[model samples]
Target: MGYLELALQKEKSLLCKRLGHKFKMASPIKTRKENRQVLYQCKICDQEAWLQWPEDSFNKLSENAEKSIA
Candidate 1:
């Protein structure tokens, strides 16, 4: 990468760390969907991450736990 690109990447990393990542759906042309998984790309850092759908039972369990704690 060129110096400007490296500097931009560094800035993005710092912004993501301080403000949290802003994620958006990746373009369909670039990724294929998989069962129970969603592809996301961070707008600030241009990094990719995955989100997996949890089973119904697991979701309910977590919700209940949070409610009880609160």
Candidate 2:
């Protein structure tokens, strides 16, 4: 889990413990930069969506910890 992932998971776990599967957050994938956009694609959910970052990030992607999104 990256910083974004960690925060998202924490929110999900807390939601589940409190609400019992009433909500969910989709997983997001960020792609390489091109032109001026950085792609963000979700890989964990059925409804796939793409997002764009304002600028390219120099930091490499890494996994922090495992936590269920739903």
Candidate 3:
């Protein structure tokens, strides 16, 4: 894979560790008029977020946890 793709995979792994669990899509993905929104949840932290397609929604939850801890 290219560097950018590799970096994104690494970031995703870090986010999983920070959140202390895996991510699950809250519902089946849907697309409408080229805009896509997906709901994601962290089982360990019970964090929920909605993010546009191709973005990392789990990172937001991990970032929030870091902020609260710091």
Candidate 4:
């Protein structure tokens, strides 16, 4: 079960990267509640395109307009 979960997570991560490229959304960063932020490196661009940390943190790319373009 643990292995399956890990694989699923990996797949999801890859899918997100793909979605970002498809939508021209670059700089995938994750921010902590404590205000510390970490940038995500894109596999598509191995270098020179790290997503800004804590950038647009509240925005979501989902189909829900309330979240996508809020």
Rank the candidate models, highest lDDT first: 1, 3, 4, 2
Prediction-by-prediction clash tally: 0, 3, 0, 1
RMSD of each: 11.2, 11.3, 13.7, 12.5
For residue 39, what is the lDDT in candidate 4? Answer: 35
Taking the tens digit of each residue's C-alpha lDDT, what string does model 4 give over 1-70? 2211111243334223333431122343333434433334335544222233343543332223345445
RMSD in angstroms between candidate 1 and the native structure over all alpha carbons: 11.2
Q: Estimate each model's TM-score.
A: 0.38, 0.25, 0.38, 0.21
Which runs of model 1 end up more than 4 angstroms from their true locations? 1-19, 29-35, 54-70
Error of 2 at 58 (Å): 6.8
lDDT of each: 0.46, 0.30, 0.46, 0.32
Q: Please, what are the lDDT tens digits per residue for candidate 2 over residues 41-66?
A: 23333222233334423223212111
Of the two candidates 2 and 4, the one with more favorable lDDT, higher being better, is: 4
What is candidate 1's lDDT per residue for 1-70, written digit by digit as tens? 2221211244333223334655555654132234444456667667665545456644554465568668
TM-score of 2: 0.25
Winner by TM-score between candidate 4 and candidate 2: 2
Clashing pairs for predicted structure model 1, backbone only: none
lDDT of 3: 0.46
